[model samples]
Target: MMETGQVRDFAVGIEDSAIEDLRRRLAHARLPEKETVEDWDQGIPLAYVEELTAYWRDEYDMRRVGTVLSQWPNHLIAIDGLDIHFLHIRSPEADATPLVMTHGWPGSVLEFADVIGPLTDPVAHGGKAEDAFHLVLPSLPGYGFSGKPEAPGWSVLKIAMAWRALMAALGYERFCAQGGDWGSAVTIAIGALAGENIDGDPCRGIHSNMVWVTPPDEVMANPTEEEQAGLDRIAWYRTKDHGYSTQQSTRPQTLGYALADSPVGQMAWIVEKFHGWSDCGGHPENVYSRDRLLDNVMLYWLTNSAASSARLYWESFNSGEMPQIHMPMGGSIFPKDILTPSRRWAEKTFRNIVYWNRLEQGGHFAAMERAELFVEELRAWQRAATG
Candidate 1:
């Protein structure tokens, strides 16, 4: 059992210093000249950055964003000297199952703002009573509002324990867990750790959006026809995708300085992701309104958390013990998800592969890109798994 301190306050108003810092960085920003690269083929363009910066300075309202989120019941709790921020929405119905959904990199609890009410209190939100769920959305350690880990061992395994402690701290004994990206990895770790409370049985089951695995170098290198296909797929992702991880894992301090300084740079970096990995194909704005993009970027900027969040890559790469998840599991696999893990690979790891989905549309931001599809898929899996 874990002890909880007083509920922490929501981030409603930005201090003058934060705004001053943003302005100072933008003013001192040593911008590079535009390259021959015409499109986002070389990441966010210099011209686009200037345009967005103008909008941010002239029009965006931090107070308005804060007020909109204030409609919910949000709180932060300190456990083991780390401040963890999360939102709790209880089901009006007495017997609804509680499902805790966690997000991955470059995101915050803001990702779920649009979908929480619909999931938590479906009846009031004009959905069937059967679809209601109690949602507990938390910021990952060193991400967004959560305090950065002071020690090295706060890897996925430790973070899993922290989450279990968090859920238990809030008085939830048995709950379903869902996540995509690192979120999915943590959910798998939760089920593996189980009730040991780290006392009795590990926790209940977990539902996931992505799984990580590295094949034995021998077989993976000299692959069969089928394995060759997976290898080729992975290589494609590496060339176009792994650059960000490589930079973060190796030289985070250098990159952090720039990302932490300029809000315009931060927004461009984060927004480009919504464009690249979402169903909008190229136009990210189609899936995430400017309000949504700003909300996520604001979580990073106001809290000055861009660097700390990037440290997860550093921690994981160093640890090198990517555990195979062998517990009862549910999966929500999206098509354009960089490198979608194979079912053959997943089945080897997850003990009970109860629910497996290959979604038709939607991409990296499954919940945000296709909320209706994401929710319905989750509901379908939960119903089948628990029953």
Candidate 2:
């Protein structure tokens, strides 16, 4: 059993001094010369980065970020020796299902802001009252406004445990869990312990965008074209794009110094992923507005969570413990996400996969990138979970 401690209201308001310091750092940032290649093979172009930093320093309004965060009812609850920050929105429908939506690294509760209205007030968003959900959006430990763990061992399993405590504390006897990236790992851990709740189950079902499943030996031996493509993509990522992961997983503290000191350094570090991982046609601007993208980055900057956030990778990425999930699982595969396994491969691990769909659009940040489709996917899973 998990116990929750005193909860306090949480509001977003960064100090003006900190905001001015960020601008000062951006204005005085030192830069390397242009990349050898014209393309992004060598990372973000220097000219592009210069333009972004100029806009960030001169035009971006930090107060707007505060206003956006203020729209939700935010709180910080003491759980397991840490303050877990979350946004909780109850639906008008009396019987709306409770849903815990978790955000991944480099993401905050901001990712799900657009979907909250649609999920919690479905009738207003062209859906039936029955489609409503009481949404709980938690900022993962060491990410966003949540209190960072001072010690090691706040791995995925522990995060799931904290989430269970949170839901229990909120009086949700039964609920659904949804996430992507690191959020998926935590949700999967919750499913592994889905059997231990007041209603005899913590998670009624789980839904994810980034599905991590170990394919069976036979399936891997002779994979389908899709499965092979997925494998190739993973391999390519390990080879070409995993440098950041390697550093975060192994030496976060070393990398954190640079990220913490330089606003432009942090911006470039995060924006590069927004460019590379998203389904945007060769540029991030195609999907996200400059303001929206900068708001997400500010979550990292204002909190100085670069080190704490990366510590999650250091804790869990090398643990080598694969949790067994027994509850109903649902998933959506975006064509341009970093990893997209075939249904056959995913089914080997998530046995009761009640819903699985390959989306024609969207990418890694599905909820932020395609809020309508993301809401629809969760609604679809909720319908299946109820049945």
lDDT per model vs. reference:
0.74, 0.88
Compared with the true structure, what per-residue lDDT tens digits does model 1 show for residues 88-179? Answer: 88888767777888899877777777788778777876677777788888889888768888776567777777777777777778787888
Q: Candidate 2: where are CA atoms >4 Å away?
A: 195-199
Return the clash pairs for model 2, or none. Answer: none
Worst 10 residues of 2 by lDDT: 194-203
**Candidate 2, residues 1-387: lDDT per residue as tens digits?**
656897789888889898888878887899988899988888988988998888888898877778898998999998977999999999999999999999897777888878999999999999999999999999999998899999998999899999989998999988999999899999888887764341467578999999977667866799888888888878878888899999999999999999999888899899898888889999999999999989999999999999999999999986775655668889999877888888888876787889999889988899999999998998998898777
> What are the TM-scores, per candidate, against the unseen true structure?
0.89, 0.97
For candidate 1, the clash count comes to: 6
What is the Cα-based lDDT of residue 96 in candidate 2?
95
Model 1 stretches astray by more than 4 angstroms = 1-11, 20-30, 195-202, 215-233
The TM-score between candidate 1 and the true structure equals: 0.89
**Whose TM-score is greatest here?**
2
